[model samples]
Target: MPDFLTLANHCANPRQGTQPNGLPYYDGQGTLTEEMRWLRSFIDEGYLWYKEVPANLNMADYKTVLDYFAVLKTPLITASGQPKDRFHFTYPSEVWEAMSGAGVTLGYGITWSRSTGATPRVYVVTMVEPDSPASKAGVLRGDTLVSVDGADATTSTALAALSPTAAGQTHAFALKRGESTQTFSLTSQKVTEAAVQNTRVISTSTGAVGYLQFNDHNAIAERQLLDAFTTLKAANVSDLVLDMRYNGGGYLLVASELAYMIAGPAATDGKVFERLQLNDKRPPQAPQMFRTVSYGLAPTSLKAGVTLPYLGLKRVTVLTTAGTCSASESVINSLRGIDVEVNLIGGETCGKPYAFVPQENCGTTYFAIQMQGANNKGFGDYADGFQATCKADDDLDHALGDSSERLLATALSYRANGVCPATPLRARSSSSTGPLQLLRPVGKEIALRPR
Candidate 1:
């Protein structure tokens, strides 16, 4: 297998730079001289921030290489100039395969958000995968986890550790609901997450409102979304509320297809959904076009397709949060680009106009930011995130997709009154306008899964 240095040189964006200097021709190991030379050559050819790299940094140390890469992030000037590069990271190949290929993860099947306030922290359930351990154990969105295996669930580290890595492992959870605390014991299992959590037609005085709690943008989501829209269309729904509160995003193709479904053939017949801009070193690729429904994941296999059931909607209400990112943001941006109204409810989106094509090296998958995505008008610099049109709390106290949920209710209120409800002073103080935090265990990367 090629060493890390060689793989880094071949795959890193920019693909050319200065070499690092160091000692150690042979640190008690054979042929240190050749290894050091190769390291210098790799750095010179592939380091994106070669000019900023310290000349005296140890060239042969893998840690040194990673440390250098960490600091050499290109600052995105549009995002309030915050020196953040959270998009770059590496994970084990097995993790990448499970998450990208199967949408599987070892846990109790609950996605959560941690509160940043005082001690004895609160960990609230954001979404629960259907039929997963968490759901089976009676977990619901907005359930405040008071304790996890007897430990307080306030800290992020504590909350993360609650996710079991091994199957059949049991953990105790004490959740607070309606001023009462209840305990449930759940055994961990390999959860295959369903992208579409819940879909129903809500009848109100105005008309039928299609409510879809879309959790992830994985490949299976393509079929799930098609089915959801098919039902909605059959019901003759007039409006849509796409709940993407806990969706961190997955495939761009799915995003495009969704935009096409909402806007329909008339608005998207020949429209550009998103445009990708590559590094100056590579040739620019064609813009991604809005696509109709297809049976398979690949574009060429659309022969078995039916006419996509589009809402033909000129406007849509999207439920968002800090967890709404990447492909999720893409859908919002693309729709707005084509003159479609996107009424954002809840918190600001996690500003990530950038994306990556996962590259494997030394049995690890590296998600390096390589491209920027813009809409038809070429306005894709939302590193500071898209602010909400109507601010509302997540209202973990109520179930998602419920008519009474704060965010959902706010959207419905806007639909009826054509005005944003006054954001309560308390809700505004706890909104997601603060600095973005990494919501999921894995870093964000938008790519097509292996078919």
Candidate 2:
């Protein structure tokens, strides 16, 4: 690895020319102060909002520098000055390597969301990865977590126990299923998430509806989606319902490929799936077209070299919630750009139109908002997020992909009648319902991992 100055200079946007203040950038043996000076200079020169920042700010340590830099970056702020940059953060190299490489983490393999309540009492299971300890322990989506190790599951201690930092840790869980409660003792392990959770062909009165629960857009998801579409196509399904309520987004290529699969070659041929806009200092990027091939985990690798399977559907129903974001929104945006009908159900998506390329400096990987994605029509400013066509609650009482699930059922109802459900499942307010805790930790959506 190069020195911090060299590494910073190499990729920092608006590369530093002579200092604007005409001060010597740094001249020392890389002391703490010198490093801070180098970082300050880098940010002062390259930050999108450098001019708006105060010239003198306290920088006592590395963490302070990061905090200060975060405050100075202006691109993250909305036009009215609200902070809109949740995607900007830094991670240690090892953590970044694990997340970007395999999407595995030390936990029990359950992605959960808290139910709105005053006192956190139930954690609703949103996704369960295949072959994980939680899955092997019979944990299913919609299961309500009541307790952990005899303590209220919503308590900080129980939540901490649920996500053990070390492998081989054991935790007992009490889950509520309908009227019955089940208990399971699960041992924490390294869990690799399966991006494609569930796929099936539902026999509907209208026709066969392909139901796919797409959780993430990781590299493995590229192949899993291809296989799922191949199965759907063989089943001769007429309509598709894509479940992305809990998906927080991943690679842009996977997003593009998914759009390609939903809209076949004829519909997507020579179309711009997504166009990336960099900062004013950088040159414009070429549009990312619908892909027909799957790439390896090494994001740039084409070693797998398999042609993507297509569904060639005219319309798709996408289930969404606040968790749906980034590349996930891209799928909805790009498809709509090309005139494909996308009917959204559930809550509004997490508004995120920006992406980042991980840049390493010293031992920390920085994920800064570097580019904005737009559709063919050049509409991309969705910072407030896309609203659902048919408003529906994420029914925690029913399993995802189940015919009776609130969001899925609403979508099915809309398909049959072309009207939104009048009285969708209503969500309980936090005061009325006990506080529900989110057990699983959320990970970053690294658009492109450095190989």
Candidate 3:
């Protein structure tokens, strides 16, 4: 590191004078947000090197930044700019009504708790899309989520637990419908999950080519992907189109598994996956520990059912945006290391290269942040996000009515220039965009199994 005083003096010189505040701020004060203050202090103290910044300085944590500024970006707003929902969060209550009436697909809907309604005094199923996972799972409109993964459902604890983790596990659910109780089991497979709203299809293409639209790298993602790929292979699908736009990310290993599936045996080429800068207090965990982290399918032999050398499918095109963070970025970062051409689009990514290993100190779960020294591609040094090879309309909501503008179209165009053929299709927007918005791929509706 360079001398801070000398650096500050050099920066303050007439030719390269310091600016007012160039860094993000945190700490919730009306004035003098802590991040900005520290940055200013660093400049004033002549700290020139990047290493001098505090380890806790997370400019990439949007929630922390938003809280520091006392801002809320997801509030529901009407055309007239009036707040639509009293609580700032609102959903379609009609979907709940339809589901309560035993309807199958409720289209797109939202839900909430009510204490006085017909199935009142509990956390009732307030909404359900007609063919969503909740709907397919037979979660009726008035059904009460009693417990999820052993946690009180009303607290959203069980719902949050639905976040994907490594393979070999299951998510348990207990529900109450009328006077009877039932349970459901969500087996995490390697296939991509239904997006947030369980609407859009992330994978769809003509011929041997397959498309996969994934949102998060959750525990079940690996198994879900494996099954999806196997299904695609059985269907004679060869080429692959992976749509990963606005994928804020979930688990890390899920990303690794996806990478290996696309790269096949070629992923063995050592490369970077983004460096993990650790907090001095933490250290790496032993590779042999083999701790059971989440409830989902356990990792199995990638060589299952294969006699010949398993060469995974060739390269893939990864959709990207500023909203893509954590494990999503890790996928792009790692894949690019193995000489895989990651067709980047949209704005700069949410730089979250540090790997968070879950740990428990006193009953409280803490995420011990560390960085990948290297990925399977052996390209871990590249950080601060990869620059986009091309750009697209990241503001999908604004482009919904604009027929000529689409990020997926741009991605497909680029795909055609490579080994994949151009297909006349539209990519899904996001998982949370609703099921009616989901691109229908494969799968059939089955009766909800009782837990």
> Tell me, what's the RMSD of every candidate?
7.4, 6.8, 17.8
lDDT for model 1: 0.71
The number of the candidate with the highest lDDT is 2
In TM-score terms, candidate 3 sits at: 0.44
> By TM-score, who's the top model here?
2
Ordered list by lDDT, greatest first: 2, 1, 3
lDDT, residue 308, model 1: 68
- What tens-digit string does per-residue lDDT give for candidate 2 at 161-195? 86687899998899987789999899988788777
Evaluation by lDDT, superior candidate among 1 and 3: 1
Give per-residue CA lDDT, model 1, range 1-451, as digits (tens): 3343543423222212321223222111224333434444433433333343456655445443344444444444334656545576667656776776567888888877766654444567767888888888888876767887777776554565676668898878899876899998988888898878679999999899999998777756777788899999999999999998777778887888898999898888778888987654457788888878664552332333656679999999999888888889999999999999999998898887876666553334556566688997798988778999988767766677889888899999999998987643133215443222334675433533222
Tens-digit lDDT track of model 3 for 107-132:
22223233332321244443344444
The lDDT for every candidate, in the order shown, is 0.71, 0.74, 0.42
Lowest summed lDDT over 10 consecutive residues: which window, candidate 3? 441-450
Please give the lDDT score at residue 41 for candidate 1.
Answer: 46
Task: Specify the poorest-scoring 10-residue window by lDDT in model 1.
Answer: 19-28
